[model samples]
Target: MGQDISQIDSNEIQKMLQKFGKLDEDNSGALSAKEFMQIPELTSNPLVERVIDIFDSDGNGEVDFTEFIRGMNSFASKGDTQYKLRFAFNIYDIGKNKL
Candidate 1:
């Protein structure tokens, strides 16, 4: 799922925004878990809840546009491998103790 953030040009961002708009069924300007899960890939993912938790940096239980962008950036391939590993670790670190 990793992609280069630097490779995300304005067109890519616009595409992302468009996709977000489509997923935001309620037009609330934020995506609820149910809304986020509407993505076909996520629909069957067992770790979907954890993924949402990781993306929702503010712990607000919803992902706004900014949070969505930040979360997507975390998966950028050009990012340090250590950072990616840490991000993956955070997804599985249920206890948050850096196990």
Candidate 2:
């Protein structure tokens, strides 16, 4: 049976993944869109599209590793804050600007 996830810190898991970049040591600044699809946290988030937009530095329909890393970092640092605030809007709209 699968472990119960109610105790999980979803945000932390998502942030951890966001901290790591796609594996590509060739100095190539691109990651296939397929690679992005493999991320579990991304399955439910529109951030996938956002990252793709940011990573496609050349607008060539692809993302290099460096660009991918940067995109993830931005999302972790900025996007996560926004997402949590969005979720907590009814409770504390102030969370939006704290980050």
Per-model TM-score on C-alpha atoms? 0.81, 0.42
User: Model 2 segments beyond 4 Å from truth?
Assistant: 1-29, 77-99
Q: Considering summed lDDT, which 10 consecutive residues are worst modelled in model 1?
A: 1-10
Worst 10 residues of 2 by lDDT: 87-96
C-alpha lDDT values of all predictions:
0.77, 0.48
Q: Quick one: best TM-score, which candidate? A: 1
Clash counts for the predictions, in order = 1, 6
Residues 1-99, candidate 1, lDDT per residue (tens digit)?
A: 233455456775787799889999999999999999986777898998988988787888899887776666666564567656777898899887878
Write the residue-wise lDDT of candidate 2 on 1-99 in tens digits: 012223335675565444434433333444566765666767776556654554465667776544444444443534455443443342333332535
Candidate 2 positional error at 36, Å: 1.2
